[model samples]
Structures are given as structure tokens and as C-alpha cells.
Target chain A: MHAFYSPQLTISCREVQLPASESRHALQVLRLGVGDRILLLNGHGIRAEAVLDAVDNRRHSTTTCRILQADAAPQPQPHITLFIAPPKSKNIDAVIRTATELGAAAIVPVLCRFGVAKPDLDTIAHWTKTVIAAAKQSHNPWFPEIKAPAAFADVLEAADDHGFFGAVPEPADALPSPAALPVDDQRQTSLWIGPEGGFAPEELSALLAKGLQPLTVGQWILRVETAVPALLAVVLDRCQPHQRETAE
Target chain B: MHAFYSPQLTISCREVQLPASESRHALQVLRLGVGDRILLLNGHGIRAEAVLDAVDNRRHSTTTCRILQADAAPQPQPHITLFIAPPKSKNIDAVIRTATELGAAAIVPVLCRFGVAKPDLDTIAHWTKTVIAAAKQSHNPWFPEIKAPAAFADVLEAADDHGFFGAVPEPADALPSPAALPVDDQRQTSLWIGPEGGFAPEELSALLAKGLQPLTVGQWILRVETAVPALLAVVLDRCQPHQRETAE
Candidate 1:
């Protein structure tokens, strides 16, 4: 069934009205009409099955849906926070969407010594909308938070979670050996990605002092955008035990 | 250091003439002339530091780089093979490029029940060039083979190694329990990605007989392109330790 996102939804209400945006989507774009069945999911994680009651041409042009069923969503696993140096706008947008789809709990953009792209408040607000849009599309229970920019030092200073830093250093000083892969405790984890030029020598020095695990992703160097998603994929895959069970 | 790829290099000679393509790139595109320093890599896993000895503007330009040092690269572990459901042209190209950067050994285009896109041999040939370009840019030790199109069944029939399938299934057959993560081994591992429409019920049924691992990348559904890189990142990270560690 086609689903829609309407934050203005009320719980236990028999009659639900679509927001103007959703109203236009159902009536004009998707052409859903009275008695047509659809699903509505609020950004807060409520899923509802309903039938369209009517489309109001006036009063913000609401479209009412009669609820057939409503239920609470189950909880997701250990949280993931991306404390990355911002890339260009396009790549950041791609990262936000994919990370949200992949179940990242929060995304915190941090400033690094080599950081190149700096997003303004308007850009940050746009990204927040991207997260909301992605959460809706992926049916995720919670959208990842898009935090304001911060100094790289602040990222390491405030860290208490199991932390990761995407870096390649002298082999001897590399990450805690893979044998010491994080134990499956299901606690929230953090991933830090550098910019196109990657972390400068002194910045890396500071991050390591704060207990950030300097890990290498693969043999080749990945771009800023690719690095973020690749790290998320690897970290989340390692952390989620339920995912491992599927392999026979 | 800037790296350039040339297939015409001979392994034992320790000296090589730039290929026609590299010659043009060196002389014309980059406008480099004699006495400039450059790095040349043989797509066959050898690196040479050479100087631009000479360049001819007329009748097939030529250049030379003397070997400062050379080493054989250790092969990537778990020998990844990406069996991606064919996506739109641009998306497919992006998937191939990103997967190669992530160290996939081969990229096999999969034809599945839910796959809506198909390409001719000419198109496949073009994508092959895309992967080669990506490999050079990433400076990856190995280049991924772009395999011909195969139905999901054919791909599985030819998959002599372990297989993991990405599919959405009912709760009764939810992916293997979380504890069964595959043990890292010095073996090739193959991954199956669903098409945009996803695997049909019957396609997944085929997996049951083959005992294919129906693992989910995570809780949410990823677009076909995102799935390719995300899945590779997770699987390859698990695969590295068990690989035969031949020191480069």
C-alpha cells in the first residue's frame, strides 16, 4: 500500500486529516480519492491503515482518512552517530539519505582541520528536511539528528561511546586489532570521517588521544562521500548481530 | 603522488614506455614534458616512479619513467564478487565504481524477477571501461571483472563459493539468528542484491533450495545502488582477517 507522512496526525482518532502537502499529494499527484485505501506513517513512528473519506478543497484543502488500524512500531537496535567533516552539499545530502535509510540514530557533522565544505543554517535546515524525508521513505522509526557544526576537538572531547576514526597510519599504531572488534554490547557507536584531504597530522594526533580507534576501511582511499557510507556499512554490519544470523 | 595506469608494462624489465593512452594523457592533457617526476602503475599490480624522459608531439607521443621502487601488492581478502541487480545506467555506473573502490574482485550483473532494467553487450562494454577508470583513480591493487548478464539462477549455479542474498522475507523466515555471522575464511564470498522492485517471492524460493544466506544489510530497504556498496563494505570488512596474509 502507498504510505504518506503527516506529522499533524492524532492518536486514536477515527478521522485523520492530511496536511496540505499530503493532501495535494493524495488528491492531485497520486489521485487517491474517497474510499481509496492507503497507509499513513507519522514521523513519530505510528503506522496507520486508512480509507480516504473526502478531499477538502477549502480550509488548507485537507483530505480525511478513516483509520482502519493503528499500531506502535518496534524499537530499532543500537544507535549510530556520524560525526563527519562535511563534504560538498550534494555528497552530504547523499550521505544523510543513505545513513538514515541504514538506521543511523544521529548524524553530527564536525569540523576537521582539512574540512572544505561549510554549510550555513539554511543548508543545515535543508539537510534536516532530507533526514525527515528519508526516514519517511525508509519507514524508519526515528530520523537521525543533524547537529550544528563543531570543532574537531569538541568531537573528541565529548566522546564516551565506542568511537571510530577513519584513518591510515603506520601499521603498528593502527586500530585496536580486529581481534578486538567491539564486543556485541549493543551500545551506541560513533564514526568520524575526514574531508577530501583527510585528517591532518596534528588533528589525527589529537583525536587518537581521545580514545578514537584509527581504523582503515580497505586497501584504497575512498572519497569523502564514499568513506562515510562505507564506514557506516562496515560498522553497522559488525555491530548488528541479527544481521549476521542471516548468513547460513 | 599522481598515479597513472598503463597495461603495456612488462614485469621483469623494471623500465617501461608509456602506452599510447598514457602518453597522450602525459603529454597533452597534463602538459608535462621531459624532466618532470611522475608515478606510473601497471594495472597488473606494480608501481614505478619515473621521470618524463621524453615526449613526441607528432606520430604517437612517448614518455619514460624510471623505476624508483616496485612491490607486488597483497591481494584484497575474501575475494569479493558483487552480484548486483542491474539498475539504471547512471546508478549502475556509480555502483560499479564505488564497489571497485571498496575492493570487490568481480562485478556480475544480475537479472532477476524484480529487476526492471536490462542492457545490451555494448552497454556492458561501456560499464567495463567505467570500472577500469574507477580502479585507476582509486589506485586499487586489483581490477574487478565485469561479468556478463546472468539470470539469478545462473549466477547461483555458477557460484561455487559462499553466497549471501538480500531479500525481504516474512517473520517466520527472518534472516539467520544474530549469532551465525560467517567465519572469515580464505575463500571467495558472493553477495546477491535485489533489484529496485526487489526479489519476487519465487526468486527467494529459489534461494531456499540453494541454502543461500538471506541476510539483510540492515533494518531498512536501500536503493539498488546503495545496497551494492553498503553490502560490499560489510562483507569485505569481515573477510580481511581470514585471508592469506602474504606481506607485500
Candidate 2:
């Protein structure tokens, strides 16, 4: 079944109206009419089945649907929070979309010393839209919370959870792999990936002082967009056994 | 030092000439002149430091440089070959780039039943360029060998190594996480990711019949570009200990 984002949808509500944007897509593009079954996602782990009751293609078109069934998906364990410094505008979009699809619980944009692009209000809003679209496309019920861009220091101070920094390994040193990290279900795990030029010396020192372990994805230096998904995948894989144990 | 691709570069060559494309980039774009030091990558694990011997900016421009130092990086262990069904043109680029950055030894585009786009000669050539560029940007000395697009059956027949198929888990079935798979350094690891709609029923059956274990990246359905990196990171993480052991 085709899934559409309906943020206002709730299990308690007998009938739900698709948002204007979704309505236009369903009516004009998908041509979904009365009695057509579709899945509704509310960006809160809710996947509700609904049947279209009314469809209007007017300027203020509204596609209304009656709820048939609703279920909340269990969120992925060891909530992954990605703190990334934005790359170029286009690359940042790829990072956001890929991070969302990879099941990041939250994405926080951090301003780093070597970052090329500074995030603004408009950029943050655009990132949120990208995250939502990614979720809808991936059929992920939960939308990753997109945090406003903040300074590296502020982000470090706020990172109270168990954290790992994705660092490019030095010539002779092999940074610890994520697989070597201990898996703990009780604590949330956060990963911080720096800009293309990497974290400045002071920033690296600060991260080490804050007890964030450095994890290397590979020998090569990965771009911000590449590193985000790469690091998340490794972290998620390391946390899988813990997830299975908790489930049982 | 900045790195440029010099496909003809070798340690024995006292002086090497950069290709016209690299020459334009070095002389015209970067404005590097004679005696400037730069690193050269041969996209086969060779990194040579060289000093510019001659700089020409004409239409058939070629920058000649004398090799100062050379070293070949050891190829990454457990060669990873990715057989992915082509996504949309733009997304396929992202997938190829990320896969290269994550250190896939080779990439093969496979045509799947549900694939959106068919790969042509032009697309294959474009993918090769993307891989080489990604290697340069990521500072990887080795560029992944980009194979011509092949049919699903041909790829399956050639995939005799240990293989994993990225599959969406059935509601009640728990697909093996990539981390849970046993890691062996003796065999190459190949991953097959389907297009957006995923592999058809017969494709899945064929994969299973060929003994490709199904591995799920996450609960959510991810885009091809997103899944490529995510799957690779997990596989690489799982294979890390083995790599270290082999290195030692």
C-alpha cells in the first residue's frame, strides 16, 4: 500500500484529513479517490491504514480518509543521534536524507572550525523538509528530530550521552573500530562527524576531554555525506546484539 | 599537498606527464606552477609525491612533474564487491561515490526486475569517473574497478564468493544483522542491494538458492544510495577484527 505523510493523523481520530501538500499529491498525482486504501504515517512511529472518504482537487484541496487500523512501530534501540558539521549545500542534503533512512534518532548540525557552510534558519528548515521527505520515502514511521545548528562547543556540552567521534586515523595509529566499542542498551549513543578538513586541534582535544572515544570508519578520509552513513551503519551494527537481547 | 590523478604514474618513471584533464585542473584551476609539490594517485594503491617540472596552459596542456617519493598503499583486505541495481541517474552517482569511499574493491551494476533505469555505456563511463573522483577526494589510493552493467543472472553466476543480500525483513522474520555473520579473511565479501522497489520474488529466490544470506540493515526501507553506505559500513565493521588479524 502507498504510504502518505499525515502528521495530524491519530488513532483516536476516526477521520483524518491529509495535509494540503499530501492532498495535492494524492489527488492530482496519485489520483487517489474515495474508497482507495492507503497507509498514513504521522512521523511518530504511527502507521495507520485509512480509506479515502473525500478528495477535492481545488486550490485548497483536502483529501479526507477514515481510519481503519493503526499501529505504533517499536523504535530502533540505542537511539542514534548524529552530530554532523554541514558540508556544501548539495552534499548536506544527501547527508540528511541518508542519515534519516539509516534510522538516526536525531540529527544535530554542529558548526565546526573547518566547516565550509554555516547553517542558517532557512537551511535548518530545508533540512527538516528533507528529513520528512526521506522518512516518507523510506516508509519510516518516525521522523528523526532535526535540531538547529549550534556551535561545536555548545553541542559538546549538551552531549551527555555516550558519544563517539568519527576521526580519520593518523598514519601509524589505527583508531578503534566501532565494533570494538562495548554495547550498552541503557545509554543512548551519539556519533559526531567533523567537516571535510576535519576537527581542529583544540576541537579534537575538547572531544577527547569530554570522553568521546574516537572511532575510525576506514583508512581513507570520507566526505561528510559519506562518513555520516558509514559511521551510523557501523554504530548500529555494533548495537544490534544489545537490541536482540533487550527484545528477548 | 593536493593530490591529482596521474594514471600513467609509476615509481620507476623519473618524470611523469599529467593528463590534459589533470593539467587543466592543476595549471588553470589550481594555478600551480613549476617546482610546486603535489601528490599523484594512480588509482591502484600508488601514491607518488612529485615536483612540477613543466607547466603548460595551452589547449593541449600537459603538466610534467618529476617523482620525488613513491609508496603503494596495501589494498584493503577482504575485497568487497557491490552488485547494485541502478537507481535514478543522480542517486546512482551518490551510491557509486559512497561505495568507493567505503572501500569497495569493485562495483558491478546489475539490472534488476524492479530497477528504474537501465545502465548504458554512457552511464557506465560516468560511474567510472565518479569512482575515480571519489577515490581522489577521499584520499584513497586505490580506485574501485567499475564493471560494465551486467544482467542479474550473469552477476549471480559470477558471485561465487561469500555474499549477502540486503533484504527488507518480513514482519515476523528476523533477518540476520550483518554484524552477526561470521567473518573470514579467506573469502571475498560481496553485497547485493536491489533497486528502490527491491528484488522481485524470483530474484530473491534465486539469491537464496545461490546461498546468499539475507541481511537487514534496519527496519525501515532505505533508498539504494542510503542502503549502499549503510550496508558497507556494517560489513566493514564486522570484518575489522579479521582485517587486523590478517595485517598482524
Candidate 3:
């Protein structure tokens, strides 16, 4: 069954009327016909069984999906937020899309001391669309919340509630242990990663002061994009294993 | 300190000259003049401090570097081998490069039952180049070895001596744990990851007959690239927590 993401179903029936973009994909690209079965996710860990009611392939790139029946809801997925010093435009776009597929709950673009890329609100909107589309592709019910690009201090202030930073640490220092971050009750987590040249020395000191962790996956040097997923793999590993095995 | 990789350092050192390609990178791209200091890593994790003596920028892409004084040897880095079903070319590139940065000892391209993209020898060469390039960039003394791509059963005979396979058990069954793998002397370890579509039922059965386990990382549907690094993160987490702590 094909899967779609529609977060609009936060309420009863949790029905998702496929958005124009998704409809185009399902109808035109996938050529999925009406009455065909498909799955819809809200990025909230809910899986809904929806049938294609109508595919208006003309002007409206929307697929009217009728609720057939909802499947047994998955256990609450981990809430992971990413705090990254947004790299160049295309790079950040790639980060958002891939991060969503890997199950990040939110992405906060940070303007760190050494950060080289900072796009305006319009650009952020475009990035937000890219992330939404990715979530839809993965059929992830919970669409990761994309925060408007924020300054370094704002991120620091939010550190206690929904923030954590990632950096390479001194040889003798230890990263936060696996036990340090747990997923017993769905506590939201934010992971911060820096840019190419890395966060400035002062930025490192500031982030460290604000309780950011200089996490390390291994001894080798990793590109910024590689770091995010590698870090998530570590973070996600700490969470309980996958709940239900899906059919291939 | 800047680090470079020089695989040829078995014997002489009176006037150690860096490879031509490295010389160009140091002298041209990085613009390190004579009398400048840098560290050259002889792919076993030994980093030697060298001063630029005669950088005759004779050729555009190749310059010469003569070693200066004391040979500074960093600790020998561990070797991690990833025997993975070659994913798409791009994803394989990601794996080799990222794995190298993450301190993989070597990479063995294994053609498994579900292997989708069968990379030819030329493609294999390209991937090996990627690993080499990543080693230089990550500043790893351990040049991850790229074994010639081979058949799946061939692996049983030559399973890296310290290798482990990542397998998730069928529903209701849990995969065997890493504790099962032998850890005699931390020799080269090969980690096997199935294709994105996962292993064939028959393949899984055959491997089970052997004592080797299809170790499962967790429950989530991890992409091929994601699975290797995540498991490596854990393996790196286990055998080299001391190193991860230091690398941070």
C-alpha cells in the first residue's frame, strides 16, 4: 500500500485530504488510481488507512482520500529536534528532507558564530515545504516543526526545554552517555550540529557553557551532513527498537 | 596541526618526501610555504611532524615535501571493515566516505541476495578512490582497506576474522546479540548490512544455519546507509567508547 502524510488529521477520524503536491505525486507520478488502498501518516506516529476517493488530476493536484479504517496506532515515536547551524541553501534543504525521513520532530536552524549560511523567511518557507514533502514520502504522521532561523542566544535559552548541541570534544572528555538520554515518556530532544569550518572557538565555549555536548560517533572526521544522520542513529538507537515490522 | 597521509614510510626517513599529489595540496591549495610545519600520517595512525624544505612548485598539481625532524606517532587506529551489499553508487560513496571518517578499517563490497546495484570493477575502483580521499580528509592514519567486491558465500570463508553481521529477526524473534561474535584481539572487523530491500528469506535461512547471527540494531526501518553507520556507532560505541570519548 502506498503511504502519504497529512498532519491535518490531528482530530477525529484523522482524515488527510491529500495536498496538491502529494496528489500530483500520487496521481501523476505514481499513477495510483481511485479505490486503491494507501497509507497516510501524520508525523505523530498514527497510521490511517485511506482509500483514494477521487483524483482530480487537472487543476487541483489534490487527492480526496476517504477514511476506510485506521490501523492499530504505533507506539509514540521518539521526539527528536535538530539544532543545526544551517549550512548553504541546498545543503540545509538536504538536511531537512533526510532528517524528516530519519524521524526528527523539529529542525531549528541556528545562526552560530561560524555559520556561513543564513536564508530569509521566504527561503525558510521553501525549506519547510521540502521537509513536509519528505515527511509525506516517508508516511510519517508527525511533520517535524521547522523553526524560523534563530540567533545563537535564542537556541541557548531553549536549551533546557528542547535543545542539545553536538560537537567534537577533547580527547579525554566523554560524550553524553546513552543512559543520559532516554525515551521512557516521549521527552522531546534537540540535537545541534555545526557547519563546515565548525562553530567558532567562542561559539564552542558558549555552547558548552549552555550544556551542549561535544558528541562523537567515532574517531574519523565526518562531513556535516554525515554527522546529522550518524548522530540520529546514535540517538535513535537509545530509543526502543522499531515497534512493528512492516511488509516490504 | 595539519595532517597528511603518506602510505610509503616503511624504511627511509632522512629526507622524507610526501607523495606528489599531497605536495600539491599542501603547497598549492593550502599554500604552505617552506619552513611551515604539518603532520603526515602514515596510514597506520602514526602522524609525523614535518617541515616544508624544498617545495619546488615545478608541476601544477604535484609538488615535493621533505620531512624535517622528530616523527610524531599518534596511536594506531583500529580497523573497521564494512561488508555491505553495494547500494546505489551515490549511497555507496556515502557509506565508504562516511565509514572511513568514522574510522572504518576497511570496506568489503559484498554482493548479497538482495543486492540491487552490482558495481563493476571500475565502479569498485571509484569507490575505493572515495575511501582513500575520505581518509585524507578525515585525517585518519588507518586507510580503510577496500577489498575487491565478492560473492555472498565467499564471505563465509573469509569473514574478516572479526566481522559481525547486522540482522533483525523475523517477528516475535529477536536477533542474536554482538556478544556472540568473537573478540579475541580486536583484529579487523567486517560488518555486513543487507540491501535496502533487505535479505532474501532463503539467504537469511542459510546464514542462520551457520553460527553467525543476523544481529538486529533495533525496530526502525533504517536506510542502507543509515543502518551501517548506526550499527558502527554502536560497535564504535562498544569496542571504542574510550576512543569516542576522546574523539568528542
Most TM-score-accurate candidate: 2
The alpha-carbon lDDT assigned to residue B95 of candidate 3 equals 83
What Cα-based lDDT does every candidate model obtain? 0.72, 0.81, 0.67
Model 3: per-residue Cα lDDT over B1-248, one tens digit each: 67776766543464566787787778878888778888677776555567777777667354445665535434433456777888888788878887887887777887887788888889978976787678777767677777888888887566744545677533465455434233443444556688876777776665666555465553445666666666776566444534233223
How close is candidate 3 at the interface, in terms of C-alpha RMSD after superposing the true interface residues?
Answer: 7.5
Candidate 3, A22-100: lDDT as tens digits: 7887888889988988887765666678888877867558788888777544543566778889888767776776687
lDDT of 2 by residue, B8-105 (tens): 98767688899888888888888899999998999988889999998765663878999998988889865889998888998889898888788899
- Candidate 1 segments exceeding 4 Å error: A56-61, A169-185, A242-248, B26-33, B57-62, B169-175, B178-186, B242-248
- List, residue by residue over A203-230, the lDDT tens digit for candidate 1: 8777777766666667886766567677
After superposition, which runs of candidate 2 have C-alpha atoms over 4 Å from their true positions? Answer: A173-179, A185-187, A242-248, B173-179, B185-187, B242-248
Q: In every candidate, how many clashes are there?
A: 3, 0, 19
Tens-digit lDDT track of model 1 for B1-248? 55677675545555678877778877888888778877666666666666766678675467766666666666777787888788888788888889878888888888987787787999989987787777777777477888889888888777754767766523465445423334643367777787875787777777656766666666776776567767777666666662213110
Best by DockQ: 2
lDDT for A143 in candidate 3 is 68
TM-score of chain A of each: 0.84, 0.91, 0.80
Question: Considering only N, C-alpha and C atoms within 3 Å, which residue pairs clash in candidate 2?
Answer: none
